[model samples]
Target: MPRFEELDVWKKAARLSADLYKSMAELKDFGFRDQITRAGLSIPSNIAEGYERATDKEIANFLNYAKGSAGELRTQIYIGMDIGYIEHETGKCWLIQAEEISKMLHGLIKSVRSRTS
Candidate 1:
């Protein structure tokens, strides 16, 4: 396996985290902002952490963590939109991106699991 930075899913996750920080920069609610940003950051963070682990099984576990974070972030995006913290279109885009990332994570996990099995 190549470096985590070399992975497409990791790159996309990093971009999403950066975009989330930029988009939420102006929001006054610290709790929500922190929660969402942490969730966003978790996606790539977990991927990198997993890649650094000793075995494919460990990596797959971390990939699952990343996928869970993606789902958590998606839920927060919806709540943010409903509460007017995010615009409808912007929320939709973020949701779509999160979903895509989750799918990618799932694929990666499956690939790793197959090899380990």
Candidate 2:
């Protein structure tokens, strides 16, 4: 496996996570800040962790967790938008990024599974 830092998807996800954190910090008053913030942080964190995993199955599990976190981020983005804690454009942008990350994770997992099978 290539280094975790060499993966484009991982790099993108890391950047997305950092951006999300910056955006979230501006909205500290959001009622569920801690939960949503953790979810956002988890997306890229899991991606990097999974990429560093020694086994294919382990990587797959972590990727699945990252995918789940992407879903959580999407929901949180919507909630943030609905409550006016975040702008629609900002939320939509992050949602798009989350969707992309999900696709990349799904593809990575499929590739790994096929190779192992």
lDDT of 2 at 72: 90
**Model 1 TM-score?**
0.98
lDDT of 2 at 12: 76
- In angstroms, give how far residue 92 of model 2 lies from its true place: 1.0
Best model per TM-score: 1
Residue-pair clashes per candidate, as listed? 0, 0
What value does the lDDT take at residue 54 in candidate 1?
98
Candidate 1 regions with alpha-carbon error over 4 angstroms: none
Every candidate's CA RMSD = 0.5, 1.4
lDDT of 2 at 51: 77
* Candidate 1 local lDDT, residue 80: 98
Query: Model 1, 3-106: lDDT tens per residue?
Result: 99999999999999999999999999999999999999999999999999999999999999999999999999999999999999999999999999999999
